[model samples]
Target chain A: MRRFVRQAAEILRGDPAADRVVPPTGITARLTLFTAAAMAFLAVFALALSLAAGRLADRWSEELARGATLRVSAPAGEMEQQLAAALRVLETTPGVTEVQPLTDDEQRALLEPWFGPDLPLESLPVPRLITFQETGGGYDPDGLRLRLQAEVPGAVLDDHRRWRRPLLAAASGLRVMGWSALALIFGALGAMVSLAANASLAANAQVISVLRLVGATDDYIAAAFVRRFTLRAVAGAALGTAVGLAAVALMPDTGDTGGVLTGLGFRGLHWLWPLLVPLLAGAVAFLATRIATTSVLGDLP
Target chain B: MDLVITFDNVAYSYGGGELLTGVSLDIAPGSFHFLTGPSGAGKTTFLRLCYAALQPTAGEVRLFDRPAQELGRDGIAAIRQRIGVVHQDCRFLDHLSVADNVALPLTVAGRDGPAARRDLDDLLGWVGLSKRADARPPELSGGERQRAALARAVIVSPDAILADEPTGNVDWEMSQRLLQLLVEFNRMGRAVIVATHDLGLVRVAKKQVPARVLRIANRQVTAAGADL
Candidate 1:
């Protein structure tokens, strides 16, 4: 423990403000800062995309899994009869709680987007709609479909499982893809930071050579660069994160009812997740700089 | 007494070009020696071996009874803290003041020992560089740079001091002052090895202090003639 504290204190001993004065300004600092900023920005998007995909999957799976839809298509004379039979079948079903048939106006409202508004539904061969609510133990969808086919030949049972399954599966795949994108972003950030650090080390070769000649160990020399780059990356990431979070906050809040894109921002407690990005980026920079500095110094006399 | 340094049949070649070959020597504790040689004779390379900075391509270099090449980074660091080195270039962190530059060894060592103003002032005064303590390396003359390097070397009170061409840029008076400081450190029981090409300085040094002059030629170190 004492050794750990001693090492930490040793690492923190140097004044970066003083030491950084000798490193010529402009290109190197710009490269490091720009890379940090770009990585952080991409990280923000990845986090949002992953969280959004997760929410999408949960919402679709929950809403559709517990509900089923009923469609009744019969002769104009038999439409009411078939809907009535389907509703009766659903009522006798073990888990069925509430079953309601759509009024003529409601059926016309459903098809208004595709057909004209002045459709005479009484004469036209339009299908009737009914929605069923299931209790704790839902009805067996195959049994219900068979009962409807025999009792009401024009009736169709849609448990919503088939559509919901594929949709939820796609959402889950999207979540994985989103997370994979985040992982790739992190890896890319590490690689870029490592390269920038290596370049910085190469640029400051004379500084290292002089330090070594004066009996500065590889650790002491590495600490200077590590401290410098780590702080820069942290500062840059903080800026990037603030901008990212602000952009997320400015997006339209599509609460539970709103469409997908409007709800792109973080939900409850998810705001805390993006805050870790800067810390992780800083840690990456710290490790990258240390590795680069030590490797270069190891090659020196 | 502990043997501070030993080189046995050490052959060092840089990428297959031999600089020093079949060299065997030992540096005893508290002994002062002048390593004199012509240009391209690997004087700096030899000094690097003393502190375990450059490993011998063959044979062994032992510092304080431990083989130099076997010393890991931490081990080499420990050995380095026991020795202070001055290069012919008299390098310094050009951004730092002379006082800060002088305090580098202590700072790097994590020593809580105070670098009192008086101590720095006195060391600077001894080297005739007290007035330039606030100056950066780039601001100082070549001789002043050499003196600052010397102050940094002795700041840690190391077991040994290794200087390569320490006085190459200074005049006779300044060189004599630098020699006196090394002689004083030797009196205080610090082993000293100075590599230089100046036979005149070596001759002048022989009068006030007993220093063995080792000459490097043909990839080996030979003692100077007795006539000196």
Candidate 2:
């Protein structure tokens, strides 16, 4: 840690002679800056996507796990009797809170997305869906199912385990993929910085030779390149991060009903997370340049 | 006198071909020596060995009582700080001004300051480059560049100075002036070794100072006769 602090201080202490050693190549400088900015921009989006997916997964798991649905299918004459019997059984079950039967308009609204607004719910033989919210420890689905089967005869209890598990798994998978994309962006950024450093070093072979001839140590020479590249990365990444945050902020808000698209942004304190992009870029550039410079200098004399 | 450099049966080769073989020499403080040889007699290679720039292929080369191979990277750099070298090409950071080029040794060693600045001014005046302090290296003549290289070499007040073909590209008058600078440094108790093929410069150097003249030919080094 002490050595790292000293190295950081040395980097901050500018070396004008060392800077003069390598003449600036305009192409490499521009290339490095542009690459860093591009990578940081992509990285910001990936971070947002991962966070949003995580929130979606958590919300889906909690809401779906805390409730159960009962569907009763009977002839028009017997439909009322079956729903009344199911509601009566739920009222006496442990941990069952409020059981409410869906009105015809509510059922039609749920099906409107698929069947359009002209659906005739009164003529269709669709089963009635009764949703019951749970409190404390939710009532056991197996016991509830046994009681409903014996009493209501035509009623089916669904704790949503079969479909909810898969949905949650899919959301979790999406979150993992978003994070993996971020990792790949970082890897590409490091590679680009390394290539730029190597090119600069190769172009300044004579400068390095002159420095080494004048008793400049390898660390001194390497420090000059490392400092220059690190600063460039930091500057480029800062600009990219700012632009990314602005883009995210401009996205349309969907209020409480927002789906995946509207939810793709930082929430509250999560806005501070993109601030780390510049720091990460600087660290990557520092390490990449150091490694390349050291390797090249070792081969010099 | 304390010896500053030693070579014990040192041999160097490139691409499996020998350039220098069975060479032994010593450089001591306050000594003045001239290395004379043909164009391809490995004169530059020998100087490089003296400064730890190149390791000997067979025997050992020592600088200030330490084996060249044993010194770490930083140690080698430290050793080099005490030994100044003027190359045949007179390499300089072309972007830097004459003053900066001449004061490069001090800057590299982290000794740059107001006092060092004054010393740089004096050194430039001694090299007759006082008026050209702001001029870049590319704007200087061959003689001027050679003088700047010499100025840089002595800026650190090194214990020994090595010049490889210092007069090769300059006129006779400029060559004599450069020789006088080396002789002045030698009189200050610093070891000076100059490698040149010009026998005339060697004779002139001998007249200006007590000097030893050595010649290399056929991969061997020997003391030259005074007949030259």
Candidate 3:
């Protein structure tokens, strides 16, 4: 431990620019900074997407699962009578919290995109619809179906299982893809850092050889490169994080606009999560440079 | 002082090309030996073996009575701390100042910085490079470079010093001064092995100190047994 400390101290003391904090010089510094900046920007998007997908999955699963739709497809004279009978039965049923019958305007609005602004509801054999919401203990699907069939022969109940299952599955898949993208980003960061370190090693071949000849071990030489790259990664990542967070914060969070793309930015503590990106980038740089340095220097005398 | 190196029937080759074979020798402590050979006679290779830089393909190289391969990198490095080497090319980090270059070995050995700062001035003075301490290696002359290499070699008061063509790039006066420094280290009970083809240097050292000459030929070490 004493020896390690001594070596660490010597590593810092050997380089005048060790902690001098001068403006970066050479192409490696510039390239490292640029890579870090671009990666951070991408990481922000990935983080936002992941968080949004997760929240979307939870919200869709919870809210959509608690509601069911009742469709009454009867002959021309009995459609309103069946829908009204089903609504009355649902309202009186146990665990049935609220029942709302869709207005003609609301039904037209739902069908406006596919049909038109002025839907011909009288000419078409469109089914009458009623939405049923449930409290904590939802109504039993089999029992409710039996009751609706007995009370209103043309009434059919949908617990939203078909639509909710697929939607939730898609949302969960989206969340997985988002996380996978983040993993790929980190892997790319490691690759870039390794490339930069190898280039620096090749450039400083003579310097490394001389230092080794003077009794510097491979660890000492590696520490120098590792420290330099790690610091660059850290500084660059911090700058990138700040810029990325600011960009994310500036995004408009307008409410849903009839299936329009919205809410692309971070919400709540999700913005703080991207702050760890720079730290992770620094760690990746540190490990990547260290591995490359040791491997390269190990091949040396 | 103790004899720190011994080679017995050591053979070494690179890329399947034999450079040294059937080499046997002993370096007594506090003794200075001059190695003179032709260009392809493996002088540098022999020096490398003595300093544990390379291991023999056959036979044995005992450094402090330990086989070369038995010592790990750290062990070799520790041994290197006590044995300074001066390369023929006199290489240095072009990015660092001369003082930093001279202080490199100390830093690698994990010496105290303040003590190195104090000793660094005296060391520069000894090599007559006090003024150029702040200059870079590329800015110095060949002679100054040799002196700096010498200063670096003896800075740790190593048990032994191995130099390959220490005066190859310098003038006669500088070569003589470098020789004088080696002699001084010898008087202070440090083993010195210098590999060079300079016949004049061998003759010059004959009058000042008792020195033995070794030659490499036909892949073997043979003592010349003569000062000149």
Query: Each model's fnat?
Result: 0.36, 0.54, 0.56
TM-score of 2: 0.92
**How far out, in Å, is residue B45 in model 3?**
0.8
Q: What does candidate 1's lDDT look like per residue over A1-301, in tens digits?
A: 5543443464457564335434654676777788788888888888888898889889998898887788888887777777788889989988887788888788788889988788788878878888877898877878887888889889888888889989898888878987898788777877877888788787778777666655566766777777777777888888888888988888878688754456677888999999998988887777777677767877766
Q: Could you tally the backbone clashes for each prediction? A: 0, 0, 0
- Over the stretch A167-273, how does candidate 3's per-residue lDDT look in tens digits? 99888888898889989987998899899988988888887777767777777677778778877887788888888888878877775431213666776777789
- iRMSD values, candidates in order: 3.0, 1.4, 4.1
Ranking by DockQ: 2, 1, 3
Model 2 stretches with alpha carbons more than 4 Å out: A1-5, A12-17, A74-85, A88-126, A134-139
> What digit string (tens of lDDT, one per residue) describes model 1 on residues B15-50?
769999999988998888999889889999999999
DockQ of candidate 2?
0.62
Give the per-residue lDDT of model 2 (tens digit) for B1-228.
Answer: 558999899999999899999999888899999999889898999999999999999999989889999988888888778899999999998878889888877887889999999999999999999999999999999999999999998999999999999999999999999999999999999999999998999898888888999888999888898685
Best by lDDT: 2
For all predicted structures, in order, the TM-scores are 0.90, 0.92, 0.88
Write candidate 2's Cα lDDT for A246-300 as tens digits: 8998998775577666889989888999999999988888888888888998988
What TM-score does the A-chain of candidate 1 achieve? 0.82
Candidate 3 residue lDDT tens string, B13-58: 9999898988888898888899989998899999999988899998
Model 3 fnat value: 0.56
Q: Model 2: C-alpha RMSD to truth?
A: 2.7
Candidate lDDT scores, in order, read 0.81, 0.88, 0.83
Arranged by TM-score, best first: 2, 1, 3
